[model samples]
Target: MSIHLFQISLTQLQGVGPQKAEELHALGISTVGDLIEYYPFRYEDYRVREMHEIKDGERITIQGTIASLPTMQRFGGKTRLICRVTVESMLVTAVWFNRAFLKEQLTPGREITLTGKWEQRRRQMTVADSEFPDKGGAKTGTLQPVYSVGGSLTQASIRKMINQALIQFGALIPEILPAELLEKHALLPRRSAITRIHRPENTLEGQEARRRMVYEELFLFQLKLQAYRATHMKQADGLVHPVNNEEIRQFVSRLPFELTGSQKQVINEILHDMKQPYVMNRLLQGDVGSGKTVVAAVGLYATVKAGHQGALMVPTEILAEQHTRSLGAMFEPYGIQVGLLTGSLTERKRRDLIASLQMGLLDIVVGTHALIQEDVYFRSLGLVITDEQHRFGVNQRSILRRKGMNPDVLTMTATPIPRTLAITVFGDMDVSTLRERPKGRKPIKTYSVKHNMMDRVLGFIRKEAEQGRQTFFICPLIEESEKLDVQNAIDLHMQLTHALPELAIGLLHGRMNAAEKEATMATYAAGETNVLVSTTVIEVGVDVPNATLMIVMDADRFGLSQLHQLRGRVGRGEHQSFCILIADPKSENGQERMKAMTDTDDGFEISRRDLEIRGPGEFFGTKQSGMPEFRLANLVNDFEVLEQARDDAAALTASESFWSSQSYKELRDNLNRDAKQQTEPLD
Candidate 1:
């Protein structure tokens, strides 16, 4: 398939000169195909309105006679147009800011239709764009698409280009889906969907078109992910390690506490996967204090008992060191040699560990990214375990796998993601959940307060510290600036140290050097520091069993999932813990978010509710995280369509006879073309 289509040539569009084309290209609209595929983020319903039924901030279309001729006046040397209109005995004022030439478009006593939001001020009604309306009564009651464009590109320009593209190629769109699959799924043909999306005759048709497109995109994406997983599984050569029940039983018996049923279930699942001939690609998802680490440790011990080496890769050096210490204590009693390798270690120490690893003298190795370095070769790496797997990309995981003879992977995450999102994001991996906390862990009491209650919050913190319990004061920013964020780490550190002069205070953030950060965390972990003021860098792996309090300043600035993870830092010990959320936003969503935190402690429930309230993109930090950026589909809002698409794809792929069909070939070619286009350089 060629990159260029008959309608994709922007040079052929009316008013899209080379200069304008370049501007459009910056918005990811280099061709007509791009314009057509750039689906609307939302629709504005302006199809029906009455003069007497006008509400404030309601987008409406109304036709009326001009009560007076539009007049232009100069305000601060900028021209403005002011006019009045009457609709069904209702009078409204219209203002066009800095649009002097618009007055000519509206003549006195001329009947015209206007589409804009109604505003009520001082018992008067006003419309922003009342002076200019399209010719055909503004096509009332239809869904109007809103495109995401750059500041330089106006919505009108996008609408125009899309309309032109549809007119040029709407009838020529080749159907790519298999006919039987489309029929079974009740999906619209490609041509009809594209046409209706660009130029719908009614709201129903527009909705149908959008549903079809969103489903198709989601289905194809899931299919690609599943195919990748299947291909990898078929080609991977894995070592089959039988379960060592005695080793696991010994480790469990030595522990002071008993494992929950959920923990035991997860351990059993891992053992089952290890006994399989194919490699294991699994994710262990659990909430804070769920004892997932111990489960992973048991899995590591089983692999080592089978005479194979395992590597635990963590995102941060602090986490790696913590894991090394915990695992070393457990394995040492059994005569298992465990080595620690991190970037912060001395050159000589790192070299020694690497030599021991290569010589098969080490049974288990734990480190950060240093473990994946080419110089650190494993004797017989069979299992690769990554803590907080979301922190690393797919390529990084692949690099670690290449180090061993196709090692079985077990990635763990404490972030309790919703089921729908987890399936969509990690559809390729087998999933196991540890829903139960340890036997003796206490539930953390949570509270949401306003900024005015700072004195009370500080008093509570002082009381906890006086009891010899550690506390964490988390901030969203590193330094105080002109923004509305709470006090920065430096400012908060100073204020807290001054307030609690008798207590030890420390600071930690991403800006600190590795040594400085490790030292600060070590002091706090060692119980030498009573209070630690820091940022979100501590959200992941700074575990202190003595810490019993978490104070999140300006909680509105952080996402619900992130706040949940931050709250997880505490409540790890037997002592009663508390997560204090201080947020003061006047918006309804802000208030609702604060209330939601106080209402529930379950991370997965919070994640689902957050998706419902703020959408999936915001819940996962999609813009920054660089997950699949869909132009047409919303993962949260269109989940039903996504599922339908997945079913449709599965049905189509299940029939072996369809692979040789013409429709199948066309679909494959179209998918390949779309994949190529999606991956191309932006310019």
Candidate 2:
């Protein structure tokens, strides 16, 4: 009677023929174990109710006798069924749209039960679910699981299939979780949890099942991340180069303004990491105008002073050029040689830069992914820094690290992740935060407007342009498609160019070539182009101090962090900048999101609220980003579970024989299979 004795084949399920089995395999539900773990998205309750007590618009079940024979008719290609029933002398009408078969099932003078929403229309009590009493036996007071289904597989069909499978395999249930771990987490037995989740007798049972499964999923993911951190820390040892603050002090002393307290604190943290024996894999997270670049420059200066090279990798050529120009100006006074390399550079220029980089003549090289190309070699690479770390994957970051003998890594991001998520996802790296903006920087006045205010907004823009100020118009899409998003870059550029031909208008999008993009950005930055119309491609780079006006059309289509980044493009100058979010205020969610933008200028607050509303998976694109994707545990709604799971994982991994434990073995096998199964079909 061992729990592990269960070994039911999926083919044994009723109505699951070979073809259906193959189709299920395509969705990665090939075995009983996989099917059991395929959790439902939501649940439905089917508790019965008294006919007289049933409230209007409330879905319920009431027993009644048919007063009149049901009538079925087709109206405008849609079938409709209507019938009258009596419950204790109270007559109630039931109507069903597209359920004509119900007319024959509920005949006159027959006692039956109806389950659906009761609606009062034109002084008549009408019910919606038009089904007979015998077919209503599936009703349960507990939460009924609702799953995601595809073509031809309705919810009822899926429920029936799963029920059949469960019935056939019920006696063969297995206990996959270790007894100690289950007890520690107060998790239910695996077999009982799975059974209850699909067909719960009560709401509490269903909730307990969900809680247990969520904990298991999050615990396993945290364990994997913790194990990765532990393995990397033990193997990759970093050289601790003591920081000589003299060089950084000299550079800072010549600055026009004093560094903010937050900036100085972050620099101190970076300096401390540089003195540590472990490799400095740290993320410098700050708001838009928090001056993360200067902190990173300090790290570069310190690394160069330690007799090693540093490389700053940006996502685009324009960002690379901007970083190179700024860093060159900052470090040249200290005699630090900074070089720029990009894909758009001439062959001869790139070759010359590569030679200097190999010869160790370039102390710091700032560029795009070109810095990690095979042709470019670093002589004494000591530190590697990447801006907008989310744009690159782990393998790409590892490739850059391979340039040197385990170079200390420093990653920077303007998108401020929540503290809890940061600790879990980036547990391997130390973190530094710059929370304050530089002095004299004005907060951009943000407003949400509808399309009707387009003309007025343009007029304001014209005024700003006349005053020698620059403007940026951000569009959600690059080109005109048949989509609902009407304000695309191409169309908007044409409209604006025609409207304001007196001012220079330039276009920048992802489809444009590198040279074209760089040229357009350069024209805008140099004040040659007074207006720039672009897509989200301009979200990361193209910093212009003269651009004082920002307008994002259909701002509701953009994420909070993306909108914040686009807004960051402006307010870099002294003039009072404005961000106009043009969106339809009729949509509640859209209004709520844009209101968040208009209310606060804090990027971290926006990100936190975004995570709370949409969850971290959507905020960071964790599924596509190759980070651990959870099925049930949401970082926002299930915050407690996430924290507990992380703690449990840390404790379990700290044990000497943790990796050799039965639970760890199963978890590792599951992870390996998950990775492999992603490449090919399940079958």
Q: Best by lDDT, which number?
A: 2
Residue 165 in candidate 2 has what lDDT? 71
Q: Write the per-residue lDDT of candidate 1 for residues 288-365, one digit (tens) a residue.
A: 778888998898998898889999989888788788888998888889988888888899998999999998999999
Candidate 2 yields a Cα-based lDDT of 0.79
- lDDT computed for candidate 1: 0.79
Computed on alpha carbons, the lDDT of every model, listed in order, comes to 0.79, 0.79
